[model samples]
Target: MCRMARPRKPLLSRDRIVEAASALVDSEGLDAVSTRRLAAELGVSGPSLYNHFRNKDEILDAVADAVSAQIDLSMFDESDPRDWRAALHDWAVSYRAALTEHPHIVPVLARGPGRRPAGLRVADAVFGAMVGAGWPPAQATYIGALMRYFITGSALGSFARGFVDDETAYDPADYPHLGQAHLLAERRRQVDEGAFETGLRALVDGLSVQYELLAPGGTVRPAPKRS
Candidate 1:
């Protein structure tokens, strides 16, 4: 007598598919991912992936949003507006850490702004904090974009080229400026290694200087008021 075959498990779902896809991205580089690859990992056929996601781009967008959800916003809670600099630095560092944790998904974020609820919330929180800190709307937006760009570039570089040597081990005699900063950063790694903090501070400082130069009391002194 022939034996009966075992039935397939009914565990397949969109959420599970996305989770598996995210795991695949975490373990393998983005170039190695595809719907077919995700399906195989999920124990389903390639076409089954489409049943859950419209296409690969949709899957990527979902994955990016999922990664974004991991970012913690509580780092921004501050009583003093002047403390905005420290709070903002902490937020940027945390954001960078979350992105770095899923380095493979960095490209997706760089490619397209994600659609997930958490992703949008993160953006809104950042912009809101900047505005609350007395930055104009446009300046807040620009600052947000600049911070994201810096995080994305660092995450990609750290993944593609490991973090130790380039950022820390430069020769002092040959590159005094880099070497000093590297040593200081190494010490501050206990606090924040200084990538996000340094970059954010410099950007804000530069913007403040520019604003002063352009504002009413600024140094753009009127054009001699002559004929």
Candidate 2:
């Protein structure tokens, strides 16, 4: 009897696992991802997933890192006379864009870089760019943290989605100022994008003022001493 020939390509892989898990989260929220479900989606046994990932959390972490890898850090270049403000504005926009595409993973990504390599690279690029642009080490760290908070918060949920689409949901007797609130859901994309842009501009503007204060000969106020 002739022996059977082995298939050319492997059935399971780390990339395929992450891709499936990410897609599951994107389509059915984070809670929808599981070892068994992922295995079924990949057409493999649950034990096979273990070969690529130790556990579900590890798989989630990989998925989050994959999303992080999608972020654009090219704006934070190592060029002289770097325009840190411009770089930050562009970086924040790019960051929001990636998170918007995968809102389900925002919580995991918001947990700081942890041991995720792609997440760490993002932090490194942001901090390095700030320092190279004349921001002190401590301030650079603060800027990185602040931007993360702002971007993650923006991606967590949509303000427009909180409102009911029914015209009578916002009763004028109770909410006189929200007469047009019912329309928010219909214009969600516009409202959310506009809100993000508005907040991004305000944040960058505020940071620009703070950056100028660190200028040579500018008044740099000392931090309050702890009791």
Candidate 3:
């Protein structure tokens, strides 16, 4: 003569599983996202996750694709095609911002775009915009790869985060070159932003110069600096 048990909550779905897995990555880092952990997070049995994703890799791929969806693709124009320099700069900014938000997932995405739809979409948007702007196929592909390299490397968070703020971390007599290492941490945000912009400007500037030779007036240059 006991009252009926309250109805159980809904079982997990692929989307829910991926979302939970992503949250695990966001909160605890990549190692925290496992089948067992995801199941626990979803309040479901481990086997239920396999019903949606064959394994952790597939689940991660889905999570990565979801991240790609967060990237901004408005750099490419439908009505008034923007110059390729501006498009590339826009792409670099957007890509960096997206990956920076999910640094833990960056390494996984570096495996290559492959058959992941959203990752492919990001790659396609960048490559297609360049091709449409008259970049040679190989060069366009190479440029796409270059941007990925920069963005992913930047996302890795090593020296990119800057050296320790403790001046004692480096002894000037022992390491004269790093005497100002603490300054990096002192101005962490400014340092990181300045480095990124410097690298971006240099990359785009070099590409612009080369593209000029490759397409001789392809994608009109803008002020010979950061486009």
Per lDDT, the best of the predicted structures is 2
Give per-residue CA lDDT, model 3, range 176-195, as digits (tens): 99988877866766777678
CA lDDT of each candidate? Answer: 0.72, 0.90, 0.83
Worst 10 residues of 3 by lDDT: 215-224
The TM-score values for the models, in the order shown, are 0.70, 0.91, 0.87
In order, what is each prediction's RMSD in angstroms? 6.6, 3.8, 5.1
lDDT of 1 by residue, 90-165 (tens): 7777888888789899988876464677778888888888777666778778878887887788677532123344
Clashes of 2: 0
Give the per-residue Cα lDDT of candidate 1 at 44: 82
lDDT of 2: 0.90
After superposition, which runs of candidate 2 have C-alpha atoms over 4 Å from their true positions? Answer: 1-4, 79-82, 215-219, 222-227
Sort the candidates on TM-score, descending order.
2, 3, 1
In candidate 3, which residue pairs clash? none
Q: What are the per-model numbers of colliding residue pairs?
A: 0, 0, 0
lDDT tens string, model 2, 1-227?
99989966566889999999999999998899999999888888999888888999999999999989998988886753448888898999899999999999999999988999999999999998988778888889989999999999999999999999999888899999999999999999999999999999999999887876675744466655899
User: What RMSD value applies to candidate 1?
Assistant: 6.6
